[model samples]
Structures are given as structure tokens and as C-alpha cells.
Target chain A: MEKTYKVEGMTCGGCVQSVEKAINAVAPAATVKVDLENNHVTVTGIEDDNLVAQAVENAGFDYEGPVF
Target chain B: MEKTYKVEGMTCGGCVQSVEKAINAVAPAATVKVDLENNHVTVTGIEDDNLVAQAVENAGFDYEGPVF
Candidate 1:
């Protein structure tokens, strides 16, 4: 399953990488895409919202819940 | 006055610049310094938290309130 979440704390390309790494660490099989322009993170293969959210927070970004 | 806000969404130097520019746009005279290492923004010469926070949101980042 693929899910997109509204996240904060990313500013540039580096931040984009961080967000991807952070999410991938938790969901190794998931493909994480960081949209810096919209502050959105799309994770494919993750089913648990808490898991992804935790990873995002651990990476220092605030997870403002999922993007509907 | 100098105020440090706990900002999120910055991952690299480019993010640092974006954050600075976002804040500076709101307060033209403010010296906005972005600390990517700590995800903090030190803005000098601004007094209204609302203004700074608004600028951040307008710049496409999430404003998670002030880091007091």
C-alpha cells in the first residue's frame, strides 16, 4: 500500500534525502519520496501509519498526520 | 530583539537559505539565521511571532508553533 503524509521541517534537497532515509530505515521495502515543494512524503509498501510517523519524527520532522 | 524558533523541514544548506529567505521576506530588517544541525531559526529584529510563523508556512513548510 502507498500512503502520503503531510510533514514539516524539510527545506532543501538534503532534507529530501533525510526524509527518505528515515522512512526507509523503518520500512526497508518501502519507497519513500520527499516532495520538498509541498512538504509531502509518499511511502509505498508501508501499511502502518504509526511506524512511518515514528520514523518521520525520529528523523526530526514533524508528522502532521497523513495527507488525505 | 533576537528570537530563536524551533523550525523543521530543513535538511541542507539550501534549506537553510530557504528558511532564511522566508523569514526575511516577512521582516525585511530581520537577520534570519538557519541552523540546520539543530533545525532552529534565529531571527533578529522581529517581534511578532505570528508574522514569522506565517512566513514559514507561506514558504511551504509546516509551522509547529514556537519552540519556547
Candidate 2:
């Protein structure tokens, strides 16, 4: 399953890296892509919304979705 | 002045902190609030959309707005 989340509070490249690292840590095989200009996060593999949400929350940013 | 940005790529609380830090570093006086469940970021004391965008981008996440 692929999921895309709308996120908030990011402010730079480091924030992107942090979000990626945090997600990868929890969802090892999850493929994550971010479009800072547009504020979108697309993830592939594993459909646990809670896990995905926790990953973003744990990383310190607000996230909303499964927007699909 | 206040601004809200939709962000992407966060997966944990740490990501939130990182994003906040990144924004503060650049804007200093800017106040930021993130609502993960809603995917919203509220920022105050700044009116520069570019700077806000840059802050989020630098923090390593994707962002969109000034959404009012």
C-alpha cells in the first residue's frame, strides 16, 4: 500500500532528512519521498496508519493522511 | 502576522522538534505550532512566505502555504 501524508512544521533540508530517517527507522522497507515545495509525503509498503502517524509525530512534525 | 503551512515527510516527535528548530534558527522570533492530526503549521511574527518556505525546506521537509 502506498500512502501520502500532508505534514506541517518542516523548515529546511534537515527537517526532510529527519522525517525520512525517523520513518525509515520504524518502517525499514518503506519507500518515502517528500516534496517540500508542495508539502507532500508519499510512502510505499506497509499500511499501518498509526505506525506511519507515530513515525511523523515522533520525528516532531504534524502529519495528516493516507490521502488516497 | 501569522501563517500556516502544510508540511510533509515527518514521522515522529523528533521530526517536529527538528522542524521547529530549523524555523526558529532562521526566523528567531517566529512562533510555530504543529498539529499532526490535522497536518497544519501555524507560524506568527513572519510574513515572508519565502523565508518560511526556506525554513521548512531547510529543516528537511516539504511545505506549502501561508494558508491564510
Candidate 3:
């Protein structure tokens, strides 16, 4: 399954990388794509959205819930 | 004096607050303002740019030198 969520506070490439890493750290099997321009992160192969969201928050970014 | 710096890995209000606290921690008299749209942090009343830069990095963000 794939889910797209809004992530806030990312401004640079490093932030994008950090977000991706954070997502992966929580869901090792998931693939993460971060749209720096859109502030959205599309994650695939993850079953738990809350885990991914926690990963984002733990990494110091705002996990603005999920993008329906 | 005021200087605007480019900081990476900031996403959300918490990141902004963390950045501000990090800056003030190093330079107690300085003030910090974060522009989420611009990806810039404008700081005032700080004497050492290097110190400020270090502070940003210490806060776990990528400090891309300065906006000069």
C-alpha cells in the first residue's frame, strides 16, 4: 500500500534526506519519496501510518497528519 | 546587526522553536526569527557568525554558511 502525507518544516535537500531516512528507520521495508516543493512524502510498503508519522516527528519535522 | 542564514532540516513549528532556542542558547542576547517560506533564519544582536553557524549545526540542521 502507498500513502502520501504532508510534512512541514523541510527547507533544504538535507531535510528531504532526513525525512526519507526517518521514514525508512521506522519502516525498513518502505520506500519514501519526498517532494521538497510540495512538502509531501509518499511512502510505499508501510502498513503502519502512525509509525511513519512518529519517525517524522522524532526526526524533528512536523508530521501534519496525512494527506487524505 | 542582523544576519539571515540558510538552515536545512527544519520542518514545522517545533523545528522553528528548536532553532530559536538553539540560537539563543549559544547567544543569550540574540533574537531569532524563522521564515518557513524562505528557508531562512534571520538573527539579530549576535556578534559571532561562526558561533551562530555552529549553534545551528549543533541543533541538528545543515547550516549552509550564510546568505551572502
Candidate 4:
């Protein structure tokens, strides 16, 4: 399944890269993409909400769960 | 200055505590309060937007700048 989250605390390209790396580390098969300008992150993989949430938290950004 | 940010990706009290600690570590005099239910973080201290943003980023939560 795929999910898109509204993220906060990201200011630059580095932040986006960090978040993506964190998510992939936890779910290697997941596809993650972050839009820094829009503050959105989309992920596709097995549904593991906790792992996803932790990845965002670990990267130092706040992540609200799937908005839609 | 005091600012309130809307944070995302926080799932539990532990997330809240982790965020608070990270902020304090960077700015010792800053006061940070996280509302897990509301997903809000209020900070009071000298205004340093970058530091605040970095602190939130370091904690692994997405933080949007002062909502109000």
C-alpha cells in the first residue's frame, strides 16, 4: 500500500534527503519521496505505520499520518 | 519570543519527550511544551528560527514554523 503524510520541520534539501534515508532504512522495500517545498512525503510499501512514524521522527521532522 | 509550531509524525508520549529534550539541548533556556493530543509544540525563548527548526529536525518530527 501507499501513503502520503504531511511533514513539518524540513527546511532544505538535506532535510528531505535525511527523511528519505531514514524511512528506507526501516523499510528497505519502501519507496519514499519528499517534496521540500510542499512539505509532503509519499511512501509505498508494506503498511507499517509505527515504522513509518519512527522514521520521520528519527529524521527530526514531525509527520502526520496519511492525510488521504 | 514565543512560538507555537504544528508538528507531525509524533505517535506517543515518548516522541513528545524526545522532541522536548532535543530542543532543550540546543537552547538550554528555551521552554518547550508538546501537546501530544493536539500535535502542537510551544516554545518560549530568544528568537532563533534556525535553531528551533534544527532542534525539531534533530528530534525526528516534522515541524511547521509558528502557526500563529
Misplaced by over 4 Å in model 3 are B1-68
Task: Between candidates 1 and 4, name the one with more favorable TM-score.
Answer: 1
TM-score of chain B of each: 0.88, 0.88, 0.93, 0.89
lDDT of each: 0.74, 0.74, 0.78, 0.75
- Which residue segments of model 4 deviate by more than 4 Å? B1-68
For candidate 4, the lDDT comes to 0.75
Sorted by TM-score (best first), the order is 3, 1, 2, 4
- In model 3, the Cα lDDT at residue A24 comes to 71
Tens digit of lDDT per residue, candidate 2, span B1-68?
A: 77788887656565667777667777789898877766677889888878877767655577776565
Classify candidate 2 by CAPRI docking class.
Answer: incorrect
Could you estimate the TM-score for every candidate?
Answer: 0.52, 0.51, 0.52, 0.50
Question: Whose lDDT is greatest here?
Answer: 3
Candidate order by decreasing DockQ:
1, 2, 3, 4
Error of 4 at A26 (Å): 0.6
Tell me which of candidates 1 and 4 scores higher on lDDT: 4
Better of 2 and 3 by TM-score: 3
Stretch of 10 with least lDDT, candidate 1 chain B:
B57-66
**B1-68, model 1: which lDDT tens digit per residue?**
78888777766765565567657655678998777787788888998999887766544455576666
- In order, the candidates keep a fraction of the true contacts of 0.27, 0.25, 0.04, 0.09
Encode model 4's per-residue lDDT on B1-68: one tens digit a residue. 78888887666655666677668777879898888788888899948777877767655567677777
